[model samples]
Target: MRGVTRSAQGRGELTPMESRILRAAVRLFAEKGFDATTVQEIVDAAEVTKGALYHYFDAKDDLLFEIYHSLISSQMADLDRIIALRLSAADTVRAILVNLVETTASRVDEAAVFTREMHKLNADRMAAFRADRRRYHETFREVIDRAQTAGELGTVVPADTAVLIALGVVNQLPTWYRPDGPKSPQQLGTEIADFVLAALSA
Candidate 1:
């Protein structure tokens, strides 16, 4: 995911109108299923003309794809940055998990909406989505694999299985996590990192 090109809004900077429209779309899509969300409703909520929305996004599907794409793209960039630091395998993995948990928890609405409505993405967007996710998974797995090969991490579980186990918990965050919960994202992320590191070291 290092060299992957981003969407039209490269570098994740969204124009004011784009941001407004996306926020409205995410809220509407979360409240009403994607199938039930209307372009008019989105425009109304965004307080923008239909033409303004069209200028930024080609269709409603684009909005849905962008919702998740922005999140994953930022995560990928963070992963790349973490890898570049060349930290010890334990520290690297901890940083990755902490960033992932914090980002996903911060945007629980985007994650939840995308999880439910991603099937509606067009074929091309769907393929891109899968590719992005695969790249993320493979990159994380490679980190674990390298650590295990160098005896930096215990091989209690295979690298692939370890990646799955680690991400499985993060992926379920949108289901039950609340921003107003007792634990802050940093606290939760640190706890998760500790748990994974303890298991790998054991």
Candidate 2:
């Protein structure tokens, strides 16, 4: 399989063909189980030839892995960049929530693709993917840990628990979040951050 190539950093842009194929893969995989979604379906949905699909991916599993990686990797890169900026831990936590919720909501199809199909990767591939996911979580945990050490957060709360709460709030937003809802993503993020901050300070 061709190694995944990026057109730019922090931009979730894909080659035109890659985009089409990915869109088809996500849609089909979401509606049909990975095992049930065939290369012909993807090629037809993508409006590409069988040879075109083969040029980009070796097989259905390869396409799935690339699609999942592309979705999560872009998110991780965006969050990592934001976290690296020296914003206050409180602000950083809020930023993390907003970013996560907004991304999850905006990329609903991709998130659905991930939640529905990630288990289809072979064990070795899944393990590597899982590690990347853990690193992203660890990124948030480290920031929360720093905040706790600096007395910005409650000393009583375990860092891992604090991180989990923050992430849990953000991660679950896609389940119920509506773009036209009363609360903006930013507002919801602030609310969640406020709850975390208050609880941690107590």
Q: Quick one: best TM-score, which candidate?
A: 1
- In angstroms, give how far residue 13 of model 2 lies from its true place: 5.2
lDDT of 1 at 70: 81
Tens-digit lDDT track for model 2 on 48-120?
A: 9999988878788777777656766777887888888988887787777777777777776676677667787
lDDT of each: 0.88, 0.76
Clashing pairs in 2: none
**Candidate 2, residue 158: lDDT:** 88
In model 2, the Cα lDDT at residue 200 comes to: 76
Best by lDDT: 1
Q: Which residue pairs collide, candidate 1?
A: none
Q: Local error of candidate 1 at 71, Å?
A: 0.3
For model 1, the local distance difference test gives 0.88
Cα lDDT tens digits for candidate 1, 140-184: 999999999999999999999998988999999999999889999
